[model samples]
Target chain A: MRLYFEKRKTASKKTLVIVPAVSLVISLILTGFLLLAFGVSPLQTFAAMFRGAFGSSRNFAETLVKAVPLMLTGLGVSIAFRLRFWNIGAEGQLVLGGVAATWTALFASPYIPSFLLLPAVLLSGALAGAAWAGVPALLKTRLQVDETLTTLMLNYVAILIAEGLFYGAWRDPGGMGFPGTARFPQAAWLPRLYGRVHYGLIFALILAVVLWFFIYRTKWGFELHMIGKNRTAAHYLGVNIKRTILISILISGAFSGLAGATEVAGLARRLQEGLIQGYGYTAIIVAWMAQLNPFASLLAAVLMAALLVGGDQVQMMMRLPAAVGLVMQGMILFPLLAGSLFSEYRLRVSQPHKEETS
Target chain B: MILLVQSVIAITIRAGTSLVYATIGEIYTERSGILNLGLEGMMLMGAVTAFAVAFHTGSLVLSLLIAMGMGMVLSAVHAFLCITMRANQVVSGLSITLFGTGMASFLGQRLGPAENNFYLVGLTAARFRRIAVPFLSDIPILGALFYQDILTYGMYILIPLAWFYMFKTKHGLNLRSVGESPQTADAMGISVTKIRYLYTILGGMFVSLGGAHLSLSYTPGWTENITGGRGWIVIALVIFSMWNPARAIYGALLFGGINAIQFRLQIAGAAIPAPVLNMFPYLATIAVLVLVTWWESKGKKRLGAPAALAVSYMREDK
Candidate 1:
């Protein structure tokens, strides 16, 4: 018998949920072995991690703090990914959003009304992120610049701009030379729900539901989906690929930008050095792992955040590197991508040819 | 003025050497239609591994080999995912980078000796130092070229060899055919899958060597920020080179020159901020990318981008 792959007529629905879950289990088992290779007890390590991430309400709330950015950026990346536009600049866009929020809080607040400060900060951040992301989108549509390279390059640029600001003009005079801006006034702060977990979690949940409806139930989503799956078919169906990509990418950047804004306004309460965390990078894993589903992204974000929080706990309690969480996040995709093959194709065992059998 | 020029040129060659190595490797990978974005990750792993191995084994050659082996392992994963599984190449590459980055960082923190307290940072091992070529050392201003580490000297030989292998040989022709039109290449009896897998892994070997050069020659040690986004810059360099290994030299020189200036400005202290200076290479890459894209849009002769760069191939589909 010989084996070959036969394309499925349609994707398997069961694997849609089952594969990721199985892949998560597979990833954990594999990471557990990795811990064993390092002479650590995987079971004990995992137990410590779980307790660190969710041992108490306080711990869970901290996990949510990390999850908020992951959720927003995951949703952000999935929108752009839907159009097959690789927006790796979510990091830069997030930084740009924070920069905009900082500008709004520090410079614009004196002129604007106190009540409007928070809205102004979030909107400005989202707009800044959109504008930063808009460059690659425009270039790709106009001149066919590689979006991946541009987006990646822009990440450094955005990080540098933020660094220059905080390390230079924005350095807090009252805070004894720390590399950060002064704290924002009360009007600009994103309200905390509990234990420093801010209102960003609510925004993320609302956006996920809204985006789910938008992507699954809307005509525009259909256009974007068609363009991603088969652009020739989309074009045959009279879809304006360029316009759809531009609009979706802008909206995508807005989410990452809002992630940055909320991070500053709600979490940090000031623009600081830690604002440029790798949440944007983690967002890619979240988007892909969630299979670009908005609602599922919320769950993936929380799970990934748990890894981060848990990884930190192990570092503190068990003396393991915090990057174990990142390693697991990175490792999950290998099996997931490999597993995707089964969803798209069924393995068939064919009988030997008659002549060969004879 | 002459002294300044000499210093800048020396810095350019030293700095450009690693970029050139990575650019050539990435060029080969892209030429075979496999875009590997995990250069930064691979480089980090290479840097950490090389430094760690050298610190422990005290064998420079062994450390370099191990670093490249690690690179080969990561790229092989990419090849399996993208080729056998027919996964999205971009996401596969991104995942590899993520894995490499985390793995490198993890090892960096864990692979040190007791005295260093289990950290690879701040510990120096055997490193390649500058040696002046006997005859060429006397040349004015240009003599700076003769004074470089062994890695840079190796670069002086490999550049032409790589260019020849790519444009002047039958194997490269097969490689080009595979990238340009895989179906046609298959019709011509070339094994597209083998060629892609071979070149991608081979290219990764060279990329990791570039990373090894950092720990063994450039910075002479491992730091968490050792690569400092050089891996990403190599992607930009590959585009700036328009996928030609020969053309890659120009991109590397420009990048090197930008870095040299950034270094000088940082030392000069106060005309411009350090962060602004640091942004130059990225900003320059953006400018170069835009210019190249705009140039290609003018419908020039050819920019050398492989027609099937990121497209996966299958026999039955054809």
Candidate 2:
């Protein structure tokens, strides 16, 4: 009996690995097809993409800068998804946070010292994201509205709100009448480690480690996993499922908020329409394809970020629109879904029972 | 006062018309226990297909037919994923939305922008000419109702039809049984997969017409995101209306009324940001969802959704 149980466990582990492995192989083939369709040599194209993104120190720095927000958004998505909340509005949450941080930088820049202002901006951004997400979480928990619909729909509202602010109230006066906030004061800026890229990378890496620890080594983490696996079971065990879910969404939203804060502080340094580079949306695929593991999420974020960076290079070089990256991103999802088919059932040969009777 | 009343009548119908069409379609899909969250994406596809076809062929009828066909094809993809592969309903629905939106945007970009004519543009969506009933069209307060398009009259016809089909017909009973309890329905020798698939496709066709109304009738020309978040709003309205078709119409009209007022209010120089006003439909949906949940949760018998809703079934194992 003990041996049988061990075999069962080993078989399931094999199944999990095999599914993802097959998915990766399929993804490579699809990528090749896409290359061929574009009339480019697949091997040469891939080499150029890699060389463009990581062959030089400057290229490597750009990749890291792109990956930073993706990691934050991935971690945020991981947290919410771990509790089975499916917060699809992280894009909106990220923007809301950026808006909040930008508002702070505009009003509070001269009032505080550099050290204090930076932290204030980041915190204010995170709080704003959490507050925005908290509304949907509360409604879903208290009123049973489907969070998926509410979150997704709210994205438009969030985008429009940001646009309204930029175009109407926050339009910069010093420069040509472009609809953008004033360039953030140098005091509001994050300390840079390299050209453009800054200390935001440190925050992303730290958060990844913290999340890994929390998810794998803590009691609350176990409760969250239980809730995700089976809410009824968690309820029976006297867990406050609603509060846990709400907390999960709030934490996730805050992390994404930090991503937006980082973008403003480290890069753009002002509130502009479309400040976020769709990192929040990409993080959904990152979180899911990584199976929601924090360490794995980091790895997945880098891979996706590489694709985006490379996509830009290929686009500029080939005069292809940036949408080719979307096709590849979508290709990954198709294979990922197909890969899950093996998890639930297996093929078996059945013999006729009538043979014995005959 | 005369202009206010006239504007109110026109705006209310305009706002609600798309919702009325989309919700009726959704009611059909959800009643069969499949949540087609791809409604927005499908509607967008419909709008674009209608416009592209109309532009190319200069035939309004052909454009609408093509749009409805596109809706079916997209819904078929959703049905296959959720029904055949037994994938997560939410994920499959979301994937369809992503794929559909990407495809539509790509196509729309390729098609380039075109002129939108409000009057002569949509034969499929052209406003039905008012037939002034001798007394009804002249009545002071009720006169406004007589000036509606053919689609409005079609909605009025559909409510009773939906009621008759769901409660009075044998097929409706079987379909509802599948939704309420697919296992029981299966045991009773019903084809659960077939019914779900059929209704999903049919429902999708209805939604595409709603999309047609947007391009061909609503604004009388093409607009990107013409459906806006109306698709999601319809999903919210289903719950708000307690899953009843007649009540769904009223709920849609209420949403339409609010939408109309927001636009009119903006034009009237309201101090609120236009973006804030645009948030009206979404805010209202959330509020309605909360109120419905609270009211229903208060009952000893939870107003549970159809038992088989969003679940995948496999017959081979059974």
**Candidate No. with top TM-score:** 1
> Which regions of candidate 1 deviate over 4 angstroms?
A354-358
Best by DockQ: 1
The residue pairs found clashing in candidate 1 are none
DockQ of each: 0.71, 0.28
Q: Give candidate 2's whole-model lDDT.
A: 0.75
Estimate the TM-score for candidate 1: 0.96
Tell me, by lDDT, which candidate is best.
1
Model 2 off-target regions past 4 Å? A1-11, A14-67, A139-146, A153-157, A173-175, A191-199, A232-243, A276-279, A302-321, A349-358, B111-153, B219-226, B300-304, B314-318
lDDT of 2 by residue, A1-358 (tens): 0110011212354556676667666766876775576455777766767776787888778878888888888899889888888787888888888889998898877787877898999999899889888988998897887787678767767777788888788878874877778888887888889876788889988999999899889988998899988989999999999988898899999998888888887887888864746677778877877878888888878777776777677667754434445545655666566555555655444346633431
